[model samples]
Target: MKTTAKILNGLLILFLLVSCEKDELESTDPNLLNSANSEASENFNNGMIKSYSSDVVIQWNELLSQSIDNRLPQPAEVKIYVMVTLAMHDALNNVVPKYETYALDNSEVDASDITKKNIHTIADAAVSKAARDMMAQVFPPSTATADALLNSILSNIEDSDLKTRGIAIGQEATAAILQKRSGDFPLAFAGYPLYTEPGEYRSDFMPWAMANPPVWPANAVYAPNLGSLTPFGIESGDQFRDQAPFPLNSADYIKDYNEVKMLGCTSCPARTEEQTEIGAFYIENTSSFNNRVARALIVQKKLDGWEAARLIGLIEMSQMDSYIASFDGKYHFNLWRPITAVRLGDSDGIDETTGDASWTPTFTTPPTPEYPSTHSYNGGAAAAVFRAYFNTDHCDLDLISPYNLPGTTRHLSSFSQMARDNALSRIYIGYHFRNAIVVGERQGGELGKYVFENNLREIKKLK
Candidate 1:
């Protein structure tokens, strides 16, 4: 009886071991389990989907930079960036339903035909096509380059149904965004009338000693119609318009006037060497510099295609809206720049301030109305997006300004630090007053937060 019992017990133990192994095998088997039902299957699905590199985004952004380099106005540059990135993001999500589409509905992307085996290839094709189409449309001069990039990307994928479907999806997304943004571009400038009142904006025709003539003719106002362009993510351009600037004779105005007069002159003895460097370092194109920083972070974080598209889209959209908001306030308030304010100080009915007609700024001022600094607004918006995307303020960034302090690298420890430096730089360069910098940065921060919290949110899966 004892021998029989031992035999049965050994058989039961063997049966239990075989059953456990079968369970483990079944749990990992993709054919037998759904990705949502099994952790192993979920990981396997993710691995397959995220296997591809997001260099497509980087490549397209580079193409955008090349196409827009000194060729288009700032508002037009912002608009082009927004359109390209939005197309990329929307196309990728259509292929893989990872994020909410900005321009298309769920019915627009027929993901029912997509499978895990071809998801990444299809996604890559879609993104490449969308970027190519948008770039070609916005910048016809770069069509050949954009075409080459798309062909190079598609070469990796075999000519199959997946590729064709991806192209269709991409074309659809591009069309949707283009249709959505139709009539949003700035109108032709009709010439702004010069206002002679103190504290009002008027074009300064003062010529300066420089190697090259300015991009715009002397006394020409830059992008006066920019304020009328429609925003991407914000409700309206003037939704966050700042309050009126300080009165010309107020104590606040007097203090800021004196501060810029001392620290912001072309050869101010009060300005420190480091402050001069800071002033010069941030003089590059705002869109270009911010995108460069963003691309670096994308590489450093090793983000996949979806993550990179989403991040770039958010950053660009935030910047576009911020520019719109800033410009709206700019044209609405029509405040005079520091150069005009300082030169006409004595005539402004102010007792304490003195006018110096011979005064010059460290850098030539932008030709827009200057109550709030648009550059500072861009800095604040970009920094907010960076911090929100990383969920932290701290990031190691090494930046160089080829436009100003060429070959000199500046290292920043956090996004907020960068924003602060950028805002203060406007003051040092004598382009903006402290109040303008402060208000612009604050408005940008608010807009950035609103956009990140609201747009392109992740599509949460049902349990």
Candidate 2:
């Protein structure tokens, strides 16, 4: 009896350790999709079916990382979807006539006349096409799905600033440019420019990158593998494990220094006060997590065909618009994070504090100004969108993150609590201030409200 009991207890312990951890995600059965199908949900379901065809989730995350680096943010594929749906919705909202046009240039309205709303239309069309192209790229033409894709995009847009502002301008612009006899707005806008010169945006990165490119310190132990089977460069798999359990590319001290390699050292740098703050901001936000548990989670409601596309498109537009606003504020305040300010306590001429020679940030510092936490705003906007879809922010769900971690999963009963948790994680990870996170959360909630309410002038409120 004693021998049997010991074996059973050992077996139970092993089972407990392995069973609760998730590995492969179970694929949802197409035949067994959502069962509680109201008209709106049915609409969402149809769009989700369309969306399911594409691998938008993966691509979208990858695209967002190109600018601001973080474990979470809005996906690009959804953003494009919202752009398209907003275009269709904007078309419906066009109630104005031509003569109210403000000419952007005297250059000539020859074959094609340009207007703001028309330009917006052109961008939306481009987004849809890009999304479709990406979808087709992944699945063969016949397998490309739009059901989930549409629902996801619509949910985002219906709750985002992009749909509201883009559509706001689109509605007014559509009416103004549709004056009597020109397809000019539609035509000219199909390829209207949305980007400013790289010179302008790169100021934030150019100096940072120039001073830092890929480098190897004199004390490094890496050596090239002569064999073709191995990567010509870095060690792979278990060989590099003992020194560091995570990826060499994982956010680390050296990686932090490399971020501002482009910018030269200051010889009494004229902007000591400004540069140090920005440097500190960079140092604080650039950490990378392969996997980390998240308190807030995402719940996607399915919408169908045209409406799904439009609604999901609105969600993305809302996020993008919020980001633009957020980005604008980042540039506006030009503030510094606590890490840098705290570290350089003596340099700033403050006598009360001392720099910790061994101090390090918990996570990587993202490369942007810090005022409003993007994570907070994005989380709040997303939470509201989900609530709008469900008509309540009370769904209990688990969020399994793809931050490259082996097993990052979190669960919550209500969407709002999850949003709060996601916002609070910044403090847990120590990258943002409580004030910034709260402000971001407040702004995001407002942004979500503005996005949904903006579309309701023509109909009864959805929720």
Candidate 3:
């Protein structure tokens, strides 16, 4: 029965791939299998074929982003990406001998004694298998899509032994990562309570403002339980947590309120066309934007499989830790969003804060407690990691929005430039105050610094 089920599952997966890949199948690119051309190519497939490790990472990252966007929260999206990418890194590391393994949860597989194997074939099989299995666990409904990718990856390997070993290694890595993530952690979305006082996050707002689905529970003293998850390199989720938002009714608070009110409204005349473009470009969710930029940088540098693997692993782990730290601050303070403050300005006890009852944001407000914007945090985290990796803030990097423009790439002079723009973008879209973006950048920078200095560093290893 098990064998028959396997056969039937394989057939179903094939049918789904054919149905979904009508256009992709039309491309007759044979070089897809041997796409890498680095110093590492000399040792690949008995010196006959090159490895495509970086391409594998890019493809899998794109697929995973699409799958998670279909159904999952930000926390889960971060978690699954970390797992699948780390598995790919560890699997390739065993063959390349460049860095120390991340030491996944239940991983006990050993390949030290194996010899005369194709690292390219092994990497391809391992990455696809690890991604397929992990996605099955996180998004069971996405099995058809996941299986199609797996079939496509495996069908390209010509060597039987390399393919078999690659599958085995990938499976072992997935098990280890799953074991590491197993335990009590906050993975579900449940509501808490709302603060109904005059100055707090107002659950009761005008019909238009509150029409879209509430971030659920309307208002919770504590946000989602992201703090419960394990940190990558930080000692705790609150390790980088900072002070609360500016004191309500302070001069600083009044200045920030007026700035956002003038520039961040749906009908603000002060906002420029360039500012509006920046806002729209960054409107993409964190996972998609960060991953897309990271992939573009990796390809531009022509990093080999193991080099790309290690860089991607570090980037994702820092991002995950930064998010945890940001959420800790968000729930601890439970600050109101700009929309809430703008609508309730009259009651905030500030002489300068005149209430605008009919005010709307330039874009829809995200469903979460305000203060210490996660988008800003994500930007800072990614920038810091890139800066650390290149050993300079002056590296040339450009990010084009997948959602906003297909041909227009925004040229960033430095990683810091990108970070600063991302921090300020919330105001352009009327989603965050200046204080939240500023503090979120600090928290994320600290998290990124900690991860960069402490973990996934290069070590002396024999090839």
Which candidate leads the pack in TM-score? 1
**Of models 2 and 3, which has the larger lDDT?**
3
Per-residue lDDT of candidate 3, residues 54-99 (tens digit): 7886787778777774255666677777777788777765544456
**What are the lDDT scores of the predictions, listed in order?**
0.82, 0.38, 0.73
Off by over 4 Å in 1: 1-47, 107-117, 187-189, 204-219, 461-463
Off by over 4 Å in 3: 1-53, 69-72, 105-117, 184-186, 206-223, 404-408, 461-463
Winner on TM-score between 1 and 2 is 1
> Across residues 386-429, which tens digit of lDDT does each residue of candidate 1 receive?
98889999999788776666789999899999999999998898
List the candidates' TM-scores in order: 0.86, 0.43, 0.81
Q: Is candidate 1 or candidate 3 better by TM-score?
A: 1
Model 2 Cα shift for residue 398 (angstroms): 1.7
Candidate 2: TM-score? Answer: 0.43
Model 2 lDDT per residue over 1-463, tens place? 9999999999999887666542221354433443323344535433333433222332332332232334222232222333333333333222111111121111122212223334333324323333433333322231234334434444544344444443344344323322321321110001111212311112222112222324322211111111111110112211211111112123432232222221212222332443333332322111111111111122143322223333443455445444544444443443444345334434544333444433344454444445566667656765665577557867765644443332445556886875676666554444555556677777767666665555322221222
Order candidates by TM-score, high to low: 1, 3, 2
